[model samples]
Target: MNRTKILYSAAAFIAFSFLAGVTLQHATAEFVPEWVKNTAKWYGEGKTSEVEFVNAIKYLIENNIIVLELDQKKTESKTSPTFENIIIPNGNSKVGNVGFYIPLNLEIEKGTTVVWINDDNIEHTVQSQDEKGNLISLFNSDLLRTGERFAHKFNDDGAYHYFCTIHPWRVGVVTVS
Candidate 1:
């Protein structure tokens, strides 16, 4: 009830609340991708197409690579969308294809959905497997025709390896954090 005691208690409460608010506000951890600089340079030099450049920018923004502290309404900040996808290119079925799926290895945050679109002119399946070439039964997709996509939402932190049952050599990985 004394003036000094009351003042000290109020200060301590305010400090504790401030620290808690800071922690809550930073719940989403953001990181910068190392390839962004090189990609930007390539775009500036006309090596990369406009669509590719735009897609890179969207990937950065949506994935929180470029964090923008916007002081606006709550819903306004959530407008940026998440677009994570892998493309099974036309010649993906071929054995020893270096780039069977565009960016054969992907790193994403938890709760992110990754889609593998079959751009090839053949049927394929996305079957999850262990690193030792054994099926782990995590995710399995039906036969995907050309233009069909198989999507999986990763909710945990681990490396998920998948391959096409028809073409086992066609393998890719999604690492979630």
Candidate 2:
């Protein structure tokens, strides 16, 4: 083949490969992946701030669309006690649909420490209460920001109801047995 034709073919192949890679990178979840890609693009174009870019990535990771690898040795703590974790997902502010705490109902054994992790961009509170709206002093997290965590040990056997003060509609229950 002619040198010019060969060069053109090579360029086309490179362009196709680049486009394919980009397409695959943003092909996971329907709306979230696209939103993440656009957020990154906007950040690169200076249309968005660094905070927004980082938050978008966090959202993606929290939603399981993206998985990050961390040094397990550094993250592991020998003194840390293992607890049952519940995630306060993003979009919990919404009235219906996917806006609520994951595993609305949880059951754990007595002496188990229940940990609530805030995976949303907005702040949330893990306030323990009863069915009649009476507050429980056993455990109450005032305000948890994104990536923050709150934990409480269930020493007794009973049903503990909790809710987010910011969005009372987002409620959950933990039964200790």
Candidate 3:
């Protein structure tokens, strides 16, 4: 090839490599909370839970809200960790009980596992499905034994609607992005 053509081709290659590196660096610049970092690593290692797993996203975000308040702590980065929680209480109006009618709003990324704990002295099952009341996966234990727990992992990317089959009065929704 001619000397000028060769030099032009080499310059083009160098420019492409530089641009690729810049793009990759920008992608990883997103900030992921340490809790989520640990959770992802642990989940990848096959750990499971029915309570804290889903709440990790919420925990990290809530704590970060305080950190980001400081000018030095905030970053121009845009990546965020998603977490949430929902507690289902037993039916039969025991009145004055906490977690009853308490709706938890959460935003979680895809592949997060949500754990549901039955703190009531009754049995409850965590079932997921569409809005039409279809059957999804059923995770439950006998009366939850008043401190029993149930957990499920969500790998898909979308919203998952869930409810308690045993108690039709119980209903909840989870959105996985």
Candidate 4:
């Protein structure tokens, strides 16, 4: 083939590839699904007493719970409230010094920070999940021994879900408003 023809073909290919990549990068992807929005509206706004709220939390766990980040923000000991936030201790029922579980249905104000301390003897993972229990993101600590801690700041106003990658059953939720 002629050198000019070959060079033109190569240039065209490179241009097309660059444009395709740019288009994909600029595309907007939806985070939460429509059904999840409907469900959140139904329950979050629904009038229910404390008992019902607890039950609803349980129900949400039974159904939609996704794991995102894993084992993130491990602390040394149960330290003082570093910032304005809430603490959820791991349940005693957990075997081998289990870590705490945060409900995926919290109503947190924007700019609020939340921390989770692992009082268990063993290590635990902190992960975030999608509405359908899909692993969205995760972070891990080598071993969050007794008094270990993890903290995260929520800046956006939306529902964030998280779980333990080591123990998928262990889950938590953060709602920023």
lDDT of each: 0.72, 0.72, 0.51, 0.51
| TM per prediction | 0.54, 0.52, 0.43, 0.43
Go through the candidates in order and give the clash count of each: 0, 0, 4, 32
Model 1 stretches astray by more than 4 angstroms? 1-81
Name the best candidate (by TM-score): 1
Q: State the displacement of the C-alpha of residue 87, model 2, in Å, after optimal TM-score superposition.
A: 0.3
- Model 2 C-alpha lDDT per residue in residues 1-177, reported as the tens digit of each score: 445434433343334345434222332444355565666656666688868766775676577665444445666754465489999888877787586677788889877898899998889999988888667776899699999999999888888999887788777999988
Q: Report per-prediction Cα RMSD to one decimal.
A: 23.0, 20.1, 20.6, 25.8
Question: Taking the tens digit of each residue's C-alpha lDDT, what string does model 3 give over 1-177?
Answer: 445434433343334335433221121113545465455344444564524444553453355521222332345454454334555555423434344523544456775667666766677766666668787554433444456666666677776666666665555666777
Candidate 1 lDDT over 1-177, as tens digits, reads 445434433343333335434221221212434354445446666677756655655565577644544445675767454569999889899886664788799999888889999989989899999989897789999899999999888989999999998898888989999
Question: What's the candidate order when arranged by decreasing TM-score?
Answer: 1, 2, 3, 4
Better of 1 and 2 by TM-score: 1
Judge candidate 4 at residue 177 and give its lDDT: 76
Error of 4 at 73 (Å): 35
Residue pairs clashing in model 3 are 50-115, 57-82, 57-83, 58-83
lDDT for model 3, please.
Answer: 0.51
Q: What's the CA error at residue 102 for candidate 3, in Å?
A: 5.0
Alpha carbon lDDT at 43, candidate 1: 61
